[model samples]
Target: MWIIGFLLVLGPLVTLHELGHYLVGRFFGVKADAFSVGFGKELAGFTDKRGTRWKLSALPLGGYVQFAGDMNPASQPSEEWLALPEEEKRKTFPSKPLWQKALIVAAGPFTNFAIAVVILAAFSLAYGKIEIPPVIAAVSENSAAAEAGLQAGDRIVSVDGRPLNSFDELSDVVLPNPGGKLTLGVKRNGRDLNFDFTIPTIVERDRFGNEFRIGRLGVASGPGEVVPVGPFEAVGLATVKTVDIMKMMVNGIGQIITGRRPVDELGGPLKIAKFSGEQLSLGWREFVSFAALVSINLAFINLLPIPALDGGHLAFYAAEAIRRKPVGQRSQEWAFRTGMALLLTLMLFVTINDVISLPIFSS
Candidate 1:
């Protein structure tokens, strides 16, 4: 069942990605020969009215659409295609204007991102959101909360005289006002404690291993209180939430690069499969959250400027747009090869990290 669920999640995402390319290509009058949902032996397939063969392959990791003029992505067009009548050649992807080609290549990643946003919006509306009440759970020794006279068990009723219903609301007020004095109204020991507290500068580690200063008040939040929201509000909140998650991911990647964070924090396919299986046990909500997270990861990852990725292709397009010419096929191939090597190395490294990080593996 876990395997089935993983495949279902990945299969649709892969199909949706390729469908983006196929639809955009057709929209631009480009001919696509094959649209596949996986690699290796075909499990099921059918030719569409446009003569495009859509197939489901045995493997489930990823898939692609083969455009007519793309006999070899790195190879120059064949003499046959070049000699073809101008009308026919015009429909070939290689013969399309640079901008059109770039858009076609970019559509896949864009579709993934768009789908993620829509899914998040839907999920947020359906499940509602739970946020931590603006309540302090504890104050660490010598921490900013301690210095601010925050008690271990205190309900933060307001910040700087503004009533806050949740810790999330307090964060909006506190994070931006870091290092500045603010008035806090707390309910503790059957009495209201009002005090002026200064937010402290906190060091946050990024993905690549570097640390940056941010605001902090060593106060822990309790479990979130679920709040229902309307569709419009859900959509707005989901967009904000998505951006927030993406920021954290980008920051984390920076920390890893700076060596402040270990690569072991990264997980590859193995970790995802394990997580999918575990989420399956917890029921639908956890599974949906896992799916949402992976979708966000997909969006961010494809945006990386690594060749063979959507971001890499976009980078090439940007260069072409600047220089007013396409990159040579050989150069593109070389860049793709280098990118593939880097990607494989990273994948293997992260897979190893996943194994090491798993307690079961240690046993």
Candidate 2:
């Protein structure tokens, strides 16, 4: 069941991502030879009106669109591509305008983001939003909130400069700023108070011995409510949710890079699968939310200026735009090779960490 769930989540994401590139490529008059969902030997397929071979492959892990004149599915150009007849050359990705190439490459990740936004909006409208109270019910002794002069019964009206209508919204802000002082606005009785205090980044361990570092405010939120939203309102809220999650991810990565958070907490495919299974067990709604988070992560990861990714291609394009010439093939190849090696090594490392945290391996 878990394996099935994992594949279900992976398939649509890959399809949507590749479709983005395919659609944009077609729009720019660049021909795509094949649209493949997964890799390896083709399991099933058909040719479309545009002569595009759409197929499903055995791997089931991911997919890609092979453009006309691409050396491989990775879109590397070849000698044959360069020596093509002038008419054919115009139909290949390499011969397109620089901006057109960038757009086609960038469309995949942006499409993933769009899918996430739509899913979130639909779900929000159906189930409504879970709204937490902004009122602080209690403040723990000697904690950040206590030291900041926060008291029980105080209402948290805002954090930093953002106004909050719910405690969950305020929590989203405070949770990512651990060990950093933040300006907080609270309403105590009839008077407003402002406090600045550093929140603690506490290391917490689960029953399975997996550890996580999270921000602790030492303040408890009051009860929560479910606010019904119309489709339009939910769409807007979904956009907000997407942005907030992106910020959280950026900050979390920065914390890890700066040595403020443990690198061991980083996860790989196995960890994500485990969580996906857990979410499935919780309910369909939870599972959908988990998928949305993954979609956002997909967008964020692809946008990083690393080689072999869309962003890497964009980086080369940026250089081309500035110098009025594309980067040398050898340099681009070496950079992509290096990036691929690093990404593979990191994936292996994180998978090992996931194994260590498994109950079967834990001492």
Q: Stretches of candidate 2 above 4 Å error?
A: 72-77, 130-133, 140-143, 161-165, 202-211
Among all windows of 10 consecutive residues in model 1, the one with the lowest summed lDDT is: 205-214
**Best candidate according to lDDT:** 2
What is candidate 2's lDDT per residue for 1-363, written digit by digit as tens?
567667767778878898999999999998889999999999999999887999999999888898898774235678898789999989999888889999999999999889889989998988899888799998999888887778999988878866878888777877776777677888888998888767788877754355667788899987778889998899999999899999999998888899877786688888877777767777888888889998888889998888988888888889889999777877888888898998899889999988876768876
In angstroms, the error of model 2 at 8 is: 1.6
How far is 182's C-alpha from truth in model 1 (Å)?
14
Candidates' C-alpha lDDT: 0.77, 0.84
> Residue 223, candidate 2: how far off, in angstroms?
3.8
Q: Go through the candidates in order and give the C-alpha RMSD of each one to the true structure.
A: 6.4, 2.4
User: Across residues 1-363, which tens digit of lDDT does each residue of candidate 1 receive?
Assistant: 557667756667767887888889899999888988899999999998877898889998778899887776442477778888888788788888778877887888778766777778888788788878677877778987788788767888888888878888777655644456778888988899887777776767544233355567777787876788898888788788778878778766775777645576688876677677767667887777777777778878888989978788888889889998778888988998999999999988988887786666555
User: Can you tell me which runs of candidate 1 are displaced by over 4 Å?
Assistant: 74-80, 129-144, 151-166, 169-228
